[model samples]
Target: MTNLSLQAVKKAFGPVEVLHGIDLEIAAGEFVVFVGPSGCGKSTMLRLIAGLEEITSGTLEIGGEIANSLPPAERGIAMVFQSYALYPHMTVYDNMAFGLKISGMAKPEIDQRVRRAADMLQLTPYLDRHPKKLSGGQRQRVAIGRAVTRDPKVFLFDEPLSNLDAALRVATRIEIANLKEAMPDATMVYVTHDQVEAMTLADRIVVFNDGHIEQVGTPLELYTQPANLFVARFIGSPAMNIIPFDVLKGGDRPALLIKGVSETVVSLGPDDKICAGGTGYLGIRPEHLRVARDGDMALEGAVLVSERLGELTNIHLDIGQDDPLIIKVPGMIAPRRGEKMKVTFDRENIHLFEAEGLAV
Candidate 1:
């Protein structure tokens, strides 16, 4: 296992900078997943780490040694790409052993490594099969097994399951999780646009946006206490419901006025920077909103749509806002379209953001 570090890592294409002074330290044996929207530099950063792209500036270190000048082969890193680039004519065993063979490893050692990787990936039975004869998931496993046979210090995955079907993706995701457990000492870095994979598989999730590291934390930390608006909306499913509001009063507890809706006071921490007569957004998760009881502060709206997804229902309400306020109700409670409803969220669950989009 190797500890990786990037200090002020910056990448540019001539004059246009893609990554701006990125500094991160990844612990040995940690499974870190980089997640963001497309063209956000997550993939570029991965490529830089894999030595596929040269860093414009800054230092990159692997195992406490400078690796910025090293080629991919000498970096002690193995990469598994999104596409299963397996050799069609070659058997799985040969494909897995190809790298070792090219490195002039003895036949006995190459055979041992191939067999070990195949067993670890549950591909032992299909070792003799060609890529065309195997299923999509099996092909992907063969690709991963090829990398595993190298016994690399760092394992890098770039959207390794993006090509698989939904069921295959899930199954492969589980396999990856188990692989992490089995190879406890191997440092793994994965890049994915899928938040579910990032949340479930990462020891720590790195949220990237617009070529910047928006936030880096445990999955629950980023979900529960987002640093800013970008992260608040990016990490969750269905996203957090954000409503523009006028601040009537401020302090530890701030009163906000949602025009044409309702006035409510929400709790804020002592360090939260908010002021009276300011404008900002009030963020509430869908699951946080519930049917309001008497005397509770609520937003009245007409139900525009409701989705009954087995155990929970997602209710979209037209609350005289540009975007509908979404509420998640327990069980299958389907409300008729245009039906009036009042929803209230717990004060503790509400998030406050400044007009500049920074969390208050």
Candidate 2:
């Protein structure tokens, strides 16, 4: 019942429109992550829900009630910004209790809520310490504790872990995951450009591009079956290798062929029918391909670059195409650069897309 729903929400600054009409419904307790490259409007959409930005048109509903005109404080939502936003001079307890105190909650009640949040975040040991005295992770916890004390129906996070070191980011990410579990009924919406964060934390992810949601799905869903070349190229590390070609021109029934791979073919039906001899892109993830034997669609490619990371060897194949193909070879069997190798992938694993970037 604590869900958030956006009905054709839009935003504009003067004449420049920042977000096209966006429609999304977030269920109660769902952990949704907004992910996209810079200037993609993911953060702007988050701000729209936080009431930080006014909606130029359309409705925003929290718990089924229209809240477009509702101020942030009145919307019963607490936002944790990327900056942590804690008072440097104040003790952790005081920082956490500040909001309740300012709102004229009973002094005893404020103390009780702060203590509860401290226990939840394990901030009790550092309650008396100032923000400057705490590590980046601890101070960020205090920032979250502040929001926890307010006990808002929904929690909005704006890249809260970007400031931490690598080790601390991992630790804090786990802690935030635990926090979500502790408040299962509290709807949470997080915004991040980091794919790892999106993959690990989101129940569902919203992918944005050019001020519109390109796709929305679970992490695995987005990673495996991207809607288009943009998403196929964006979701994974090193990205999916895209080799563009003319499908229908190559053969019968509008089949897709992988050049450089000797005769590896994926026959497409009417659903994937390409304009006869028209162009399309062939996409395959690095992990799904190998440097060994290939079937009918196998190709011989030159290893333009090789990256050995102890656990795995990433072979970037200069497959005589515009889009350099990358194949993730399992284990540490290093392949030398400039060496010729046959790259293979299963037919089912191949993704076909039309000239317009729509999946076929």
Candidate 3:
């Protein structure tokens, strides 16, 4: 097991910089997940750590040793890609043990490692089966088992579950969570575009945006208190409902006007640099909005659509002047489209942000 650190790590292709000075420390035994949209340079950062790609600048350390000059094999890291890289003719057992054999390990040691990995991955029954005979999930398991056989200090997974079906992905995700539990000392870094996976699996999520670290924290922290508008909108389902508003107070008490809704007085003064009468956005999550069972901070609207996903329903409302706002209502209380509705949310639940996207 090892702690991995990247100090001011940057990557470039010719003159185009892809990663902009990433500084991160992955603690030993921690399951850290890098999550972002496509072209965010998350995969590239993982490749740099695996030594699959050369570091354009900065230092990379594994177990307190500088590894920038080291090759992939000597980096003490094993990588599992999205595509299960397996041998067509070789059986599962042979495929898992091939690397050890090529490294000149003793036959008995290779047998022990392969058997142990197979048992750990529940692949003992499929060891003699060819890749063509296994299911998609099994093939992915075999790919993971191959990496586990290496007994690497650090493990890198690049969207290893992307190719599986929804059901299989859930099962495999549990399998991976168990793998981390079993190997408590092994440092694992995962990269994915799935927010649900990131929220569920990671001890701490590193959110990347345009080759830079956007926000790094536990899933709920980033969701609840995003530093900027991009993260505020990006992390939530249906995203946060953002509407333009004016600051009503800045000299003494801080208050923001929500146009037709109501003027919300802040819990504290806008010493956060929000000027009076300046344009900004009011952010409120769909789940945070309260259904107007009674008249309280009421805003009338007509329902445009209602999506009932069994346990909960998402109501999209047309408020006339503003863009459509979604409200999450618990249970199957189906509200008809074009039905009149009133929505309200407490001042504490509302988020205030400056025009430049910064939270104020």
Per-candidate TM-score against the hidden true structure: 0.94, 0.93, 0.92
lDDT (10s digit) by residue, model 3, range 1-360 = 699999999999999999999999999999999988899998999999998889999999999999998988888899999999899999999999998999999999999999998888889999999999998999999999999999999999999999999998988898898898889999999998777788888998898999999888888888888888888888878789987777765356665665653443433334545533377888899998868777465666888999999889999987754688899989988789889888888776777787888887
TM-score winner between 2 and 3, please give it: 2
Instruction: Score each candidate by Cα lDDT.
Output: 0.89, 0.85, 0.86
lDDT of 2 at 236: 91
Best by lDDT: 1
The candidate with the higher TM-score, 1 or 3, is 1
Per-residue lDDT of 1-360 in model 2, one digit per residue for the tens? Answer: 389999898899899998999999999999999988889887788888989999999899999989898988898899998899788788999999988989999999998999989988889999999999899999899999999999999999989999999898888898899999889999999988777899999999998898888899999999888998889988998789887776645355657665554445557665655533367788888998976653444667777888988888898887777767888987887777788888777767878777788887
TM-score of candidate 2 on Cα atoms, chains taken together? 0.93
Question: What are the clashing pairs of model 3?
Answer: none
Better of 1 and 2 by lDDT: 1
The order of the candidates by TM-score, greatest first, is 1, 2, 3
TM-score of 3: 0.92
Q: Which has the better lDDT: candidate 1, or candidate 3?
A: 1
Candidate 1 segments exceeding 4 Å error: 250-253, 262-277
